[model samples]
Target: MAVCKGCGVTLQSTDPNAIGYTPKEGSEYCQRCFRLMHYDDLTVSMRTGIDPDQIIEQIAKMDALIIYVVDLFDFEAGMIPGLARKLPDKDILMVCAKRDILPDTLNHEKVARFVFARLKELNIKVKGLVLTSKLHSEGIDDVKEAIRMLGHGRPVVVMGRANSGKSTLLNNLFGQNILTSSRFPGTTLEMNQIVVDGITYIDTPGIEIENSLLMDVNESDLKTILPYKTIKPQIFQLHGDQSFAVAGLARLDLMECDHAACVWYLSDKLQVHRSKVQAADELWRKHYGELFSPVPLEENFRVSTIRKNLSKMDIVIDGLGWASVSGQISTISVRAPKSVNVTFRKAML
Candidate 1:
């Protein structure tokens, strides 16, 4: 059976709606990949149906070296909890992708330290770590060198969360766009193998982030939420009770604080509206989609109250950007999609 060169699905000319469908039998790429490559169109949502546990099980049975990719910007969401325990005995190399998105002034050493510290906390062990950016063509050589040294003549498996840049990283290493990659989550539906410089690399389906805002929003809204360029932190000084509406997708309200500095690191396209905390509810109820869009399809929201005693810390909205806070102790209320994950951590900046 002929398989699609792009997404590794069995090719079929009979069905237009099914995956791996092509108008012709001998086409190199399926119609889905063709549209995504040339027209930037997405025909399928790989978020559902694919089983992540089965994917991990298949990986565990393979003897290939594992190359775990994680998005640097959405680090917490990209992490596979209990990954080390699941893939025991396999030599894994962690690739922190999208290093270009972070502010350039930030120290790389500090970033590395942060990554290692987080890894230790998560109990995920790796043979090595490499930071990569497709925009600057960074860390490709380091990845190649590490693979050569640690691969032990086995096929290399590339795995990570959806939209984590696994396929893009592979294309960067290969010096060509041989696989289908997109800003849309779940581009790769199956395991696709490619050989470059005598090294066999297998691209697997991206593990879905169950509680991510990315999963909840429409594709068009993703353009504004996912940062394509380096972020310029938006700094806000809060004196009293204040609320910020992040494009109607999420809300952050400072209920009590003496004085605090809140810095937002997100896509420049997103519009953040500032208002008095007393008026926030009325504003949200009155003009959610009109004034504070693009909103999620469902209006159901979950409010989380966070008491921050740490002088400097980050409030991370999974799959969305984080807000770093400093100064006096504060009480914050985050209103976001009920399914989305919101938590606090040590400041990334």
Candidate 2:
């Protein structure tokens, strides 16, 4: 049986509704990959079926260098927890992708330091770290050099969360779009290998992020939610009580606070509506699908009350951007979809 050149699924002439179906013989790509490449259409949602633990187990048996790709914009959701414990013997190189989404004014050294600090906190050890951008060539050469120095005659395995730019990074390394890359998650259904510059590289299925808005929203809303360009931080001043509804997907309510500044780092297409704390609920109920557009299919929401005494911190909504809050003392409440993860961490500015 021959596997698809784009997505590593066994090709079959039968079963048009099933995965890996091809109408003709000797097709290079599966039906799903072919449509995605030609028409930008997704035939299946790869988020539900793939087993992440099984993927890790398969990687554990391989004797190759691991190149862990992560989305710099959605770093929290992109991370695969307990990776070091599972692949303890493997030498992992963390490649932070989509660096272009963040502002260029921020120092790259500071960003690297922030990534290292987070990795140390999570106990995830890496041989080295490289920040990359698909639109820029700043770190592409560094990635190649790192792979050459660290590969040591072993195949390089690329693995990361779904839609984290794994295939895009590989294409960048190859200087062409050899693999299937799309906005849809789970583009690579199985393991596919490619040889570039005398080095073997394997592309693996993207591990699904269970607690992310990316899984909850419709595919059409992705363009508005995911940042393709540098984000222009929208700063809001809060004195007593105010609430911000982030495109009906999530809401941030400042219950009580002294003079504070909340800087939002999100897609320019999204609308951030500010209202008094008392009127927030009414406003949401009145205009959730209209004025506040692009909400999840289900209206069920989970509210998390966070009290931050730190002078500076960030409230991160998985797959969505974060808001940096700075003040003496503040009590904030985040209301979002129950499945989406909401957490706080040190400000990454």
Candidate 3:
């Protein structure tokens, strides 16, 4: 059976409305990809063909070199638990995707070291880490060289959480646009295998994200959430009670603090609203969906609050990026939608 070159689904000419439908036999691309490529029209992405855990289980059972893809901007969202325990005795290569979106002045070695340090702190074992940007064709050769040296004639498996650019990297390696790449999650529904120089490269389905804001948002909101270009840290200095609303996604309150600086690492498209506590609340209540714009509209997100104390820490909100808060702030309050994971860890800068 011939699979669609764009989405890797079995091509069929029987149904005009179904997924992977082609005009006739010998068609290389599906109608869905055809419309998406030419008219920018998107279709409903499918799931449920295979469980994400089952795919991981199969990969663990096989003797392969795992190329674990991760988004550097949304690092916390990509860290799957028990990943090391599942793939025992297998060489894991950590590919940090979307490296071009980070500030250019930052030292590369320092960033790489930070990645290794963070992974070590999480107890995830990996042979080496490579920073890549599929958009700019960066780190492609280095990644191929790593695969060549580390694979040792074993098949390669690429896996990561949704929107981690798993398909984008595959297209980069294939030297053509074969896989369907999109900003939204659930783009790849099944595992796909492609041959490169007689070796197999497997593209597994992205791990579904439960607590992500994307899960509860509209498809059009992806442009505001996903960063496409380099992001400059928005710096703020605070002394007294101050609050910030991240486009109605989360409300961050630096309450009763002596002195501190909070650096937000988020998409340039999302605006950060900063003001005094009283004004912040008034504004949030009045202009959430309007002024705050791109607000979480689907789910009626309850205002869940979480408090954390830190000297220098990264305040993470699941799918969204984190904020590096530093100084004498004894307590911080995070008010966001319920089910969204709000936690802190040692600063990863």
Candidate 4:
């Protein structure tokens, strides 16, 4: 079967609306890829991600060296829960992608430390961690060398959550857009195999995140939420009960706090609005999608309350970013779309 040169999907001329369709004979690229690459048009709704069970089952059965890609920005969403339990004895290499989106101030040592800490908490056991950036071609050679060293003449499997730059990283390493990659999630459908530098690399489908904030919000507002460039950390010293909204997608209401530090590490594309806790509900109910722009397009949201008893902790809103807070706030209440993947973990960074 002939596959598209851009994305490794089987080419066909029967259905124009279907995936990997090409009207012209002997076309190297699919119509979907052509439109995206040239006209910047997205003809597919990738919000509904692929099921992860098939991908996980297949990966668990492989004897290949696994390269697990992760997002530096939304680390929690990129993580596959119960992954360590599934593949306890596999040789795995963690690829932390989108390194260019982080500030230049972050050095290798600091990043490594953060990754290690997160991995430990997640219970993911990896042989090594490789940081990569498909945008700037940073750390590409190091990844290639690591693959060569750890692969040990076995097939290499590259995998990660949707939009984690798994396919983009491989494309950068080979200097070819051999796999489909986009800012939108759920691009790759099945597995695609290739040989480069005498190593067989399998590009598998991206695993779905069950409760991602990105999955619940409007598609048009995604560009604003997902950072295209480096992020500037917004740090605010606490005074009293304050409420902050991250776009219209998430509302962080600080129920109680005094002399505490609340630091937000998210995309600079998003704006943070602060108000008194008393006025939070009124403003949100009356001024949704106005002062709080990018409100949920259709999904139903729920109110979740978490008490920050830990001395230091990070509140993670899946698929968006996380906020680190010092234990000054007695309680933090979040109003977000249902299945938005909110979690509390020990402070990272």
lDDT of 3 at 128: 86
Consecutive 10-residue window with the lowest summed lDDT within model 1: 44-53
Q: Which pairs of residues have clashing backbones in candidate 4?
A: none
Q: List the residue pairs that clash in candidate 2.
A: none
Error of 1 at 335 (Å): 0.7
List lDDT for all candidates, in order.
0.89, 0.90, 0.81, 0.82
Model 2 C-alpha lDDT per residue in residues 37-121, reported as the tens digit of each score: 9998998878666888888899999999999999999999977789878898788999999999999998889999999999998
Tell me which of candidates 3 and 4 scores higher on lDDT: 4
Q: Model 4 segments beyond 4 Å from truth?
A: none
- A best-first ranking of the candidates according to their lDDT comes to 2, 1, 4, 3
lDDT of 1 at 84: 85
Model 2: lDDT equals 0.90
lDDT (tens digit, per residue) of candidate 4 on 72-155: 888888888899988879999999999877777989888899889878888889989888887679888888888878988999
Which of the two, 2 or 3, has more TM-score? 2
TM-score of each: 0.98, 0.97, 0.92, 0.94
RMSD, one per candidate, in order: 1.1, 1.2, 2.2, 1.8
Candidate 2 wrongly placed segments (more than 4 Å): none
Highest TM-score, which number?
1
- Say which prediction, candidate 2 or candidate 4, comes out ahead on lDDT: 2
